[model samples]
Each structure stands twice: as C-alpha cells, then as structure tokens.
Target: MTQLFSDMFGTIIDNTPYMKAIGAYYAGASEDGITMAMPWREDLVGDPETRVIASGVVTALLDNCCGMAVWDRINAFKAVATLDLRIDYMRPALPGHELKVTAKCYKLTRSIGFVRAFAYETSVDDPVAAAQGAFIVTALKSDATGVKS
Candidate 1:
C-alpha cells in the first residue's frame, strides 16, 4: 500500500470510536483492497424468529468496509460521507457466524471514491451480501461542526 493509504488506515483504526465500538478490526489491507471483521452478537440481530442478522448491521459492515477502501486509496485522514450505497442480500446469516467484509477501491478521483464490497460468512465464494457505493471525500473536520470544507 502507498504511504498515504497506510497512514489513513492507521488514523482510522487509532481514532474512530464508532469503528472500535462495533468491533471492526483490520484483518488485512493493500493499496487497492481491505478486509474487516465484525463479530455477530445477539444485540445486533434483527430477526429473533429466524435467528438471522439484521440488515442494518449488514449495511453498517459494508459501509465500514467501503470506507476503508477509500481510506486505503487516499492514504490520509479525510472526512467521508456516503453519497450512495446499494446492497443486495443473497442469503441469511446465522447468529453464530462472524462476518468478514472485503472491499476494494478501483476508482478514485479528487472528491469521490467508488467501491465494491462483499460480506462472507466463511468463504468468499458464498457471500451473504454484495454492495456497491460511492463516498464523498473531504478534509478532516471536528465532529462539533458537521461542515466539511
């Protein structure tokens, strides 16, 4: 990975509280790729009857993975806002299975990044969900002021 992307990854892993709260750990990353792990907990499950994971949790995992892809390309601490995200749920995820999300940034420009991500239970060949999205990249700003310049 480039120095910029490496630096950005470090900044995120070290400073993002939400990422930490969700137990998002960096599995591995390269210049054009990233993998993140999120353990399934009962608290995050949505369907009690089916014992399946919630769609929101799946979305969050994809979002984080996609963001990491962008971060990996930029290689810097930047404020990112999801412009659009599309997720396709292919299969139900069991309660006890941990989800692994792998994302890649194939295209990045001055202010936008495009990424694709997949959530796999144990094998990449069998993905639970697939996602494609774009994110608006901006300079880092304090949370107190939601504005990004």
Candidate 2:
C-alpha cells in the first residue's frame, strides 16, 4: 500500500491544540516510523527548582506520536482512536533537555493498529519512558478525513 502522511497529516496534526500548547512539533518520518519533538521551556517545568518537564507533557507527546505512526503505517487518512496507551516511565527526563519521541506501528489489522514508542533525550536504550499502545481504526466516508465520532 502507498503510504500517505501529508494530505491528512497537516490537517489533523497541525491543528492539535494540546500539541501546540506544549510546544510539540512533527520532527519527521522515516521507514522506521514517525518522530515528534517537544521543547523544554520554563513554563513546562514540573518543579521550579529541578525544572523537569511535567509528566503529562511526555504522555501527550507519546500519544500524538503513536497516532501519527498508525496513520503512516495504514497509508491512509482514517479515523483512529487510542483504545489504550500504557507508558512506563524509565526515568525522569533531564532538565532543560528537549524530549524526542518516536513511534512505530508494528502491526495493523483490519480494525486495530499496534504501536510501540520511546521518549528520550540521548539514546533510545536510555529512554525516559516507553509506551506500547493499541489504536482502533475506523473507516471514513467518501472524504476520508473526518472522524465519525
């Protein structure tokens, strides 16, 4: 199947308010999967002194990354919902370091897509968090862009 990540990619991803609010941006995509980045900002610090990013921000980053990976794998613009996302925090991210997240849609069936993602600053092996999630995919109408529900 021909992979599609542009037409519907910007329409849905660029408009995500949560992604924007936390300074998350689409880094790029490769044969491996989709990648996204979040900047470390003073406003995002969980503790004023430690300056570690809030945990919720990392969760959001990984979630969006997973969704995009599913879209890239399916090679179509379809409605996808996160059925479940389990993120295991390996360690707290380094202060003042930008967090990078990459996700791969390793398996896709007619109705479900499975993804595994890692959030890290330096190396994937030394990840700040690891997530494995399943997304429920649904067919779209003729337009193929809108989420039915």
Candidate 3:
C-alpha cells in the first residue's frame, strides 16, 4: 500500500470513487504540511475556451486538502465535516496542468481543526487560489459508509 493508504484515514479516502475519479492523490506529508494533487481531467473542465477547471472542483480540492491535513496531524481514522471553507481564486488553471494543493494544520483543538491551503498549477509562488477552513472531527461511526462521512 502507498504511504497514504498505510494510514487508516487515508486508506478510506483512497478507496472513495469520486476522489479516485478526479485523480486526487496523496503526494506525502511532512512537518510543514500535507500535499495532494489533482491531475487535470477533460471532464472537470468548465470552459472549453479557456480550459479552466470549474470553481466547484477547486473548492472540493481545497476542502479535501484541508481535511487530509487535519487527518495527518491527528493520525486517526475519524470522520470530519467541513464547518466553513473560503477560497480566493487568483487565476484560472491552464489545461493539462496539474493542480497541486499544500495544506497545513496550524491549530488543532479537541474538536476543531484549522487549516490553510494553497493551490498552484505550475508555481507555488503564483498560486491559483488560497483557502482557509475549519473542520469538525468526530469518531468514525459504523453506519457512516459513504465518502461524505
């Protein structure tokens, strides 16, 4: 198994169909942060003219990256729900370019995890979007089987 899958929470995320379909992969984690990548897909493109990725997809990427950062720090297979996510889109991503997101969990309390993430196409210095969010972490329940859980 990949290092990402070796962790319980990441294993569950890897098996999720939607995440797989979007080509979101765990690049790795470090003391600095957790990184993930979403490979450009034709299906995810919103404007064929610009070949820019959809805003919704970008939001999802940010949300997942934040959640993963929290999970990596917590080192547990817990269910997390996004309390709020705010993204600032700086520019559009070019077609065929991969979107890389690096998320850092700067603060983690008993129930809430605070994260900040940036998405870039080719250069981290020139990010396409930046995000900050919070998530509510809870114990994984047997009844929660879907990816949303």
Best by TM-score: 2
Ranking, lDDT, top scorer first? 2, 3, 1
Stretches > 4 Å off in candidate 2? 1-3, 6-11, 142-149
- TM-scores vs. true structure, each candidate: 0.82, 0.87, 0.85
Alpha-carbon shift of residue 46 in model 3 (angstroms):
1.1
lDDT of 1 by residue, 41-119 (tens): 8777799998787888888878888887887777666877788889999999868888888899889999899999989
lDDT of 2 at 103: 95
Error of 1 at 111 (Å): 1.3
Off-target runs (Cα >4 Å) in candidate 3 are 1-10, 141-149
Pairs of residues at least 3 apart in sequence or in different chains that clash in candidate 1: 4-75, 5-75
Who is ahead in TM-score, 1 or 2?
2
For model 3, how does the per-residue alpha-carbon lDDT over 1-149 read when each residue is reduced to its tens digit?
43552255456558768778787877777665887788899999989888889988888878888888888777766777788889999989768899988889899999889999989986678999999998887767644322252
lDDT (tens digit, per residue) of candidate 2 on 1-149:
65466446555666887787887888788776788888898888887778889888899889889988988888777888888899999888899898999999999999889999999997788999999999889877444433321
True lDDT of residue 35, candidate 2: 80
What global local distance difference test value does model 2 have? 0.83
Better of 2 and 3 by lDDT: 2
